[model samples]
Target: MQVELNSVWQVNGVDGLEKALYRVLQLYMKQRVVILFPLSDSKALLRPVKIDFDNFSEAIKVGNARPSRYDLPYYQLQYDDEISREHLTKRDEKYTLIVDLVSNPDFLLSFVERPRSKLVSLHAKTHNTYVQNIYRALNLYWKYAQERNALLPGYKNSGGRGKARVAGEIKRGSPIQLSSSSIEAPKGVNTSESDKELFIKAMKKFGLRGEEVKFSRVYDKMLKEYYAEELISAEAESREAKVPNYRAFIYWVKKLIPTDTLIRKQTNQGDFDRNKRGLRGAATDHTEGPGSCFELDATVLDVHIVSDFQRNHVLGRPTVYCVVDKESRMIVGLHVSLEYASWRAGRQALINSFTSKKEYCAQFDIEIEESEWPCSHIPLRLLCDRGEFICKDAENLAVPLIGHLSIAPPYRAELKGIVEHRFNILNEKLVHELPGTTKGKQYDRSVKDPRLDATFTLREITKLLIDEVLEHNSSIFQDLAKQSILLIESGLSPTPLNYWNQHVKAQRHALSKADEVHVRSRLLPTTKVTMTGKGIRLNDQMYFESDHPDFDAWKIIARNNGSWSLDALVDHDNSSLLYVRLEEEGSFIKCYLKKESANFANRHQADILFFKDWVKLEKNKAKPSAKSIERHNRKKQVIESAIEDTKLEPKVGSKSKRTKGMKARRREAILAQRLEESGAKPDQEYSSVNSEQSSQRIDDDRKKVISILKRKKVTDNET
Candidate 1:
């Protein structure tokens, strides 16, 4: 049985558990294995009977009184959580009580359930014996109650008088109701039946115990479906004209936009509307005047043709420059040429347009029925892009006869967008309809495309352009008659020739019949030099003297390939070698030197060295001294020793013998003989003469001593 005597964690108090201790005795003391609860009671165990209290009077009473369950020997298990003098003195005392109050569980019980009397007794032990007597009196009362069994309601005393209270009456506490039915209601509070019912329904719908359904997912799905429906309806509503579909818009953006910023939302509405709107209505009021604005451009043909005269038995194909009048949209000029878009080509086209006879012009002159003056009436402004031809001097495209020409700005394709768009339409509709266009279809399957040979020459590309232009003017008509106004006013014969003649005839300073080569004052300035037959003419002052020795027996071509100064080209009489001016400015300059001229020049000043000789003379000025040569040799030796590990063998095909035949064997034998002569033989051990001599003396001394001893022995024996 475990016994306990209660104490407290604090100084003075009557603990609730300690007040109920005697009642526990009434309930459980009858058992043979009695466990005195130190957690609830500070009862001292004496010799005869248990005091079950810490005070002296209670101990005396318990020692004398006879209780029913006093048969067993008792142990008092008191715990002192704090090391105090009162508790220490009590521990040191020699009472007939076995007190154990040291270990963890015992201390914990006393600490958790300390009684007020025990706390009082602890103070009394230090203060006065009177307080101790009071503690003892309370302890006696506790013992008396335990013997009579007359304690509180929750706990019974030793006698049966406390039994009725333990059964029904209150002891430790006053009469109180703990059951929910017996609880008193607070005043001035009321609840309706409807409110309660509503609260219950709300709890069932959104309570913590059940699964919660989120409406956001459903809302998102509904939004997506709604967006899809709205998009479909928007697309259906916008099906007007030749607008592109959504798929085409995607394709355009994919091809054009940068990958990182290629978001559909970032696309501009203006660009979208423009791309969706296809080509329409070529006519506009922006056309300048009759023959004032000309649209000139070249287009490449899809067809391929052979241009070599021997193979094809055909002249070169032609390039036609079709200049359309801005008002009529009619061809003011059309000419074919072997050159494609070159200055020569464009000049030829311009010349051919104006120079064509009235008879030939009349043949295709449907626009102007019958007029003698025909195209020779009006002044014209030739409009085209800033191509090489349109920007060249008189002999090229700016013939004195041709009118003022205008050039479009660089990369502003929209200025020439009229021609570009027209070309596209022709290719899609008319050009592709031709047999020439379909010729490339056969080479589509070849790994080495046959178009390599069949590709269109510049001539062929020209003819195709001409044919397309002529067909467009004759066959195609404007739906609105006003659209044809520009075409009619642009030319006489409704072609290139009509416009050129009109431009030429209206010229203020027309070309004289004699001057085929126009020498414009603007081209040849007064200060600039010129090339003539006389040679090196500066501002028309000739300087070349063919009779001079420098030019003897030589043909000199006096020409300047457009540099600041004249360049001399003197050819040898008997040889193909040409000598050019080497040092004209009293300074050395590189020139093509004929061997003969070079020899002559050197002979004039025999001792004077040329640049190459001077270079050699400077290099030979400083040579290495003997001491430096010796140091270099020593350094070279060191380098050779460092590199000796490299075993060099000649290549097999080289002049030296590579095979291990007679020559290799002979070389090996010679090397071995040299090694033997040097005393580098593998089996030879080299010892110095000094070490050999010292060892030789020791051996000789041993032989000499033995000889002496033998002689002495012989002598002794004889005696």
Candidate 2:
């Protein structure tokens, strides 16, 4: 077999051989060639060798040159040179070549035998096509090795037939693939449009730094859903169908909605035509003053006062009754309570909102005392729901104090839309959004109790209320007010104090001391007490005369409920009692006692014990010790006499045997009486026994009985 050049190229013998081998390898690497060869002396010398460069074969035919019987094998000579090893060349450019021929058989037999290509011929000669092809591959590998050696720096071996072994160190270093630096993209090339957009938007909205937001695995998925699926292709002209993934679709949808949105629509009552017809901006013009548009609304708190003593002085979360200024959006007054929402709450809220001196001055920066300020320029036009709290007054008595005139949104709630709108904003922006809430105090307000995990104490709740108030009052609202006062103060603008001073003025039309006194009188305590025919008796005091106005009126004097030390009302002011008439006790006398203290003495302790236990008892059940008094009264006459005798002498210790015996007999009689009282009957003969006969049971009984009878006789005679 002979190899032919596919493409002719110019070179010397060895160089041509190397070039030819390289071409073959290039074809083999490209999977183009099936076989390769080194130039053969003649066809017979061409035999297979290993494919590696070390075993590459360059063939030479000596048809009659091997005539001697002792001639070394011709096949052995084929591998004498580096180019004769195999079918292809192997590149190991870093290594240097060194050949050692082992002429001594003894050293060759050892495990450390060195190669001496001229001496031994161990491999068998075979003409197998597969083996021959392997040889061709080895020769081709040699060509690449020689070329690599030529290009490698500091390589020394040249034009030698000796085999080369790797020398020095292979370095044991990692390949070029090992790297520490991140793969940086080219300058100005941003790969993620979606990420950049999100980062920018977030930075703008939240005032966050760009680097503060990072892209997690979730961001990738979001991008795929939003940009890949949901965003309208401006290229196409219609809204796209939603993606299957809920979170991604929701994200896109959320982005579409305005971040801060306000919606105002007419209710079932229809358009607010009255205001519409008057002026283009009549609402603003009318609400020009501080008190111009009074906004009244109820805020229900989750806090409640837990009266269940088992829980102890727990303050319940409270709901707030709020009245705000429509023009300023400032909270006018807040009445917090645990009671259900009512006109009373609203009225009280209204009162509190308008009354505070601080609220009036909040709009202005200049410090002004209450005396210096004037009444609010705006009329006290009240705005609120048409609920009972706003309408009722004859019963709660708060109606007359509310205001001169009030206007409610008649069918269309949007007429008084400011308060309602403010409530929603305030809840999300303040109350509901607050952390760490608690119970309400017994302040006679109507706040509810919050649950335990989030329940804040009354003090905590109060502080939170104040904090929210400050936030609402001083906070920069985006829509109502053009710029956020809070954010502005943080950066470009002055403090809220400065803003108020510059734009707003203090309003002074607050309640006077006299008005406060009158308001206090309305809330005075008027407890009911029974009347005697002679005078109005309170407790045991009797001083008022029948002619007094209060005597027949069944009257009471009004006083502040907080004064626990004050005595009951009486007609005779000179007689110490405030309202009692100056007269004697009439045909019948009436006594007044605390409802909790009116009970029999014998069971007093148990009654108190019952009181102590009352908090633990189930509702609507009579106490366990209710009849304890009846049980104590079942005592014998002798025991009763002994008790009276002991009381007379006041002895601390040492009683006579007769006295002890009488006491024992009394105890037995008491037990018997108790049994009867408990619905049991005794034998009749036991009751009829004489005292003398009973004395036979104990000698001391006679003496004790004699002493008792003698004392009784003397007492009877004296009477």
Candidate 3:
């Protein structure tokens, strides 16, 4: 029978032994074989024997001839080079020692052929280095068919890990020293089962709660409550207590309680889940490539900025929204607005991500090539926190624009860590370095007020943010963990822009082209606007007029009937234009702000709203002022005096008689009043001209009265 080297053969029913297993180590001339026998006893050394192939075959055949027949060609072979090499790599010291000793031909031959004592003598004499346990090394080499890694020390099984020791009569730890020689120090007792129960109860009372208690405080509370008798005695006698020490209490606490449970019990669930949870994977784990997924988040910037319209008026800190690509760590879009961190500001950021950066930068007087900030396509998936993306408006607006919308759980900001981290990067790079930055600690802020140092306007800060984003995209990222084989082979620098460009060049990007107009319409928030006789009105302050043919017809309908309202998508960043949805699907009419609402144009919607609120506040403040009250009282007195004068007038003869020739009476009263005010008599020649003119005016008035009476008579006859 043919036998392979390193294969194990079992000979059962042997003459002297019940069974014997031998590994074929080497094959010599004339079918001679060198084999190793691994004994069942672990303490016994491995036995190596050389025998002829015919004899080995006969022993196997004899075993097959027994009543309880055994297989003739029994072989058990198991050897893995990869596993053995891995084992060797784990223990460098043992592996190196074994390899150095075995490298010598004379030592290796003697180790395998000679007896244990002889091999040890040879090793001691030939080499200056000495192995403490040569027999153990030999046995390991022979047992594993001469594999070097089997000689490694079994340190993993050496220590009695996870095994607890029972407490003995003696004290567990060293005794404490006493300050006074008269008072003897007490030996601390071991933590018994009852003591462990007390410790657990104390921990539950003090340590295991949402409100965090310091370790020392917990120990004090435990001593005061659980070991009050011992503490009192020690205090009265001025000696240490015989109870378990703080060390033993802590050991038992750690042993009995799991780390996860301890942390969970001592922290708020939301804070623990958001800030202290283990991160199993990355945001880019599911992303295919650049543009595959985008993370969106917003934060109030740390720097104060002035209003763009009024530079002297500080607008406070602006809310900045960032959209980051998960794969490349690129800031695909950014928006700085005076609005709060709401969906309104978030949607503007999304719109910036979906549109061309060239035009966006141009608006801020920043010139850059399209290649510098090439991100302009919608991603397959969008991730955001619950603050801005959890509402119905966000769902309605965002669901149609992307393939999937991932709204992270409340208070879990780590889910959108890519964008959250980008906010930090921007703040550190630009915002914190700028003037009027509220970046220092509260105590340190007593030095100077950041608001008083405000210099940049909203537009200026926005431009700086854009510049910073561009610089960040081009800067090298050292912590980039994931890299494709092609990318590495190409030897490209690790920059977000480079990663993006390489992915696009290799056609491995997940960018989807979308019409800018459609994306803008979908991303912008929509509000109900009333179509009035003048124009479409937003928030009862801003009016927009559309030039569409139906606009005039709709205005006429609103004039005759009551005004109707429709949903119009509005960009809060600019109130100059609004997108009014028409009856046709996917059709929107551009509505320009009317001349009446011109004051609101070219300003943010938030700014206009703030101005209106300020106006109302001023009006309310003036209502209770002394000057306003005095003016109101004066007007009331004047009206009452005029009513008293009217009451003093003479009574009229009859209703018809009093009403007769009322126009002539009113002319004569006006003339007398004008003449009395001038205090002058009319000249004779001027009176003649006035008489002629009055006669002509009388003739003209008579003709107008006849025309009106004839017309009224005809209308009454027709009726």
Candidate 4:
């Protein structure tokens, strides 16, 4: 910003105006006199003015304010305080500038014609020649101010008197934004200082939060903070640093460090994964029609409820399972249990979702119109998170039952927003509001023993959740209805069942009785068990063909496999039953327990821990004394006699050859009985087995005859 005047220089017209402004630049660039008084005009106009801004103790007011119309003289001299006093006084000085009157003569009358003392007037009667000169003069100084403001250093480009912008033409409303961090890297800098500052700011906004958040959330915070900085300065030179060009830099940094990866590195995989999925899921269109897609997820219900078996023992928090239709947002199926969010909890929830409304409502004894909970059809696609959904057990159950199954990447609940939102509703709107509710956290549980206050048992909690889900599905909300653009267009109200009823396509896939049996069997947890001559040994307990009709076929499968080790499916929820593939029948047969362990309470809600505790309990059981054994047999005999005395004829729903029971039948006679028996018996002796008639078989033939003669029979006449 220096001008070397070797010898003397003179300019004629517009060029002379630029020269005069450049002289002011050279003086200010080398001297810090801005904080001082205005340059004094006691020094001649032809003489250059200089003052040391750092050390000056003098004042000089330099301008020709009083002038006569008769002499050719300058009115206002050049003034550039744009970044001057701000650097000096440390006040709210903005990088703005102003232009003073130049010696140009055309504009001299323009200022005069404005009614101010400038040697002329712009009245209606003023001469045409003077009026024309006024406009020309106004144009000339505007150009001069533009030239002067462009040449100052550290003068940031901005807008208005408020934003301190450069002298220039303006377009419509400002589309370009400005921020300080968007300032260009000063020349000779090796790294992206802007990017570094942005990283620290973004991390401060998001990563500093104790809990792990999603990349989208962090990116959003960064974008918000980025806009708050000073992007473009008021100097014409800095105008080229507009933020429109570098808008992508902040976002690119966020993408470089994915939030999901951060969570995986620093926190629980499940916690991070669930949140990541939720964040990732926000960028989607979930307005699907009913039965097209459904989302399933599990969360620990916020309330503490007692066990159904022991009301005094409070279960910390019951895990809740929900299956929600993407389109209708209906809670189609729900399961609330003490079980953790494993395959079994998700299993029961899936079954409830697909089961008939009549039967499901009967369990809770809730009466409502079938239309109130109409979502019974299986969805074409089933969506779930990575936790249980990624397991083979979950996949096997969902794939065949649903045509398409989607397990979103871990920790991403956003991918399954419908069910997650429903879970939030249950926590905030239902569980947390109830008595005995822990309201989350162990410290929260200590204020009062939820156990002492706990009135809701496991069964009651399930009922409460069921009632809540039912109400939510059937409740009408105008705001919710408006969310579906299609529904709004169609003039439909938003209730879960209503959204489903009006928009669901006719191609809904429903499970038949056979399909339910197939899917239910697949959902069972698989384990390897030894098939011995006695029976299948599981948990050191035996299962015999006599226990259930299914065990008979299951035994045959074991025989076909050389009567050794085989894979069997177990219902952890119902330890009383087991299933094995019947290749000839093209289905699975249900096996009942021949002998149950002492802990096997049929109605007791069971989780994986039940077996773990059972194992531990059995290990420490004391052996019975001789007198206790004798008394046990006597009690068993008395119970048997009582059963025989009070037994009623077992009702016969269908006819089968096994009804004869013992009847003094030979082993061959009983062995020949096979309703679905196909193919020749296996030639290999290991694969073949013959059964003996039971000495104590229940006489179904006598029962069947008596049931037909004197019972509630559906005869044609009665029908």
Top TM-score model: 3
Best by lDDT: 3
Across residues 145-219, which tens digit of lDDT does each residue of candidate 3 receive? Answer: 566556544544346767766778877666787789998766667789888888888889999888677777888
My TM-score estimates for the predictions, one after another, are: 0.27, 0.32, 0.65, 0.45
For model 4 the TM-score comes to 0.45
Show where candidate 2 strays beyond 4 Å. 1-285, 302-317, 357-379, 389-404, 410-413, 433-454, 457-460, 478-514, 519-622, 625-719
Report the Cα lDDT for residue 121, model 3: 51
Candidate 2, residues 1-719: lDDT per residue as tens digits? 22232311222233113422222222232322222233332324232111322112222122211111122223223332533223223223122111121122232223112334422232112222243333333333233332323212222234443442333333222223425568642222122335435534432343222223222433444545445634455326564333223333234334543432201111111333432323354244555444555667665664443322234544445566666666555555665554456654454454444343454334222344543322222225566666644444623554444444455655655565666665566566555554423322233336533344344433344445654655565655444344224334434233233233333433322222224324423322233443444333344432233344443444332222221222233111012223321234422222223233334111212223334556346555655473665555655556899888888984545656447678669857976876677655554435534454466667766556743444434566677
Clashes of each: 29, 77, 0, 37
| Regions more than 4 Å wrong, model 4 | 1-286, 364-370, 392-397, 441-446, 483-492, 505-514, 527-586, 589-719
- Which residue runs of candidate 1 sit more than 4 Å off their true CA positions? 1-283, 312-320, 357-379, 389-404, 421-430, 434-471, 483-719
Q: 380-406, model 4: which lDDT tens digit per residue?
A: 678887777777766656677777888
Q: What is the lDDT of candidate 3?
A: 0.75
**Sorted by lDDT, highest first, which candidate order results?**
3, 4, 2, 1
* Model 4 residue 132 lDDT score: 34
Q: How many backbone clashes does candidate 4 have?
A: 37
lDDT of 1 at 339: 43
Residue-wise C-alpha lDDT for candidate 1, range 1-719, written one tens digit per residue: 22232211111123222322221221123322212322223456211112223332232344421122221112122234434555455434411011222212243234324543264445445544555443343343233322211111111244665233222222222233357866663221122233234333332333212233232332234324333565466578873222222233333334343443333223344443334334465533554344555566654444444442223322223344545555445454554443467554454344333432243233333233223223222225455666644454633425445456667666554556555665565567555654435432444564554344444533334445545555555543433244333335653444333433443445421222212112112122123233334333321322333323543222243333332343343211111221223224532112333333333221101111223354477799878989999999999998897677444633466445555387547755765676677867533422333356569879999878843444444566677
lDDT for each of the candidates?
0.38, 0.39, 0.75, 0.55
Query: Poorest 10 consecutive residues of model 4 by lDDT?
Result: 64-73
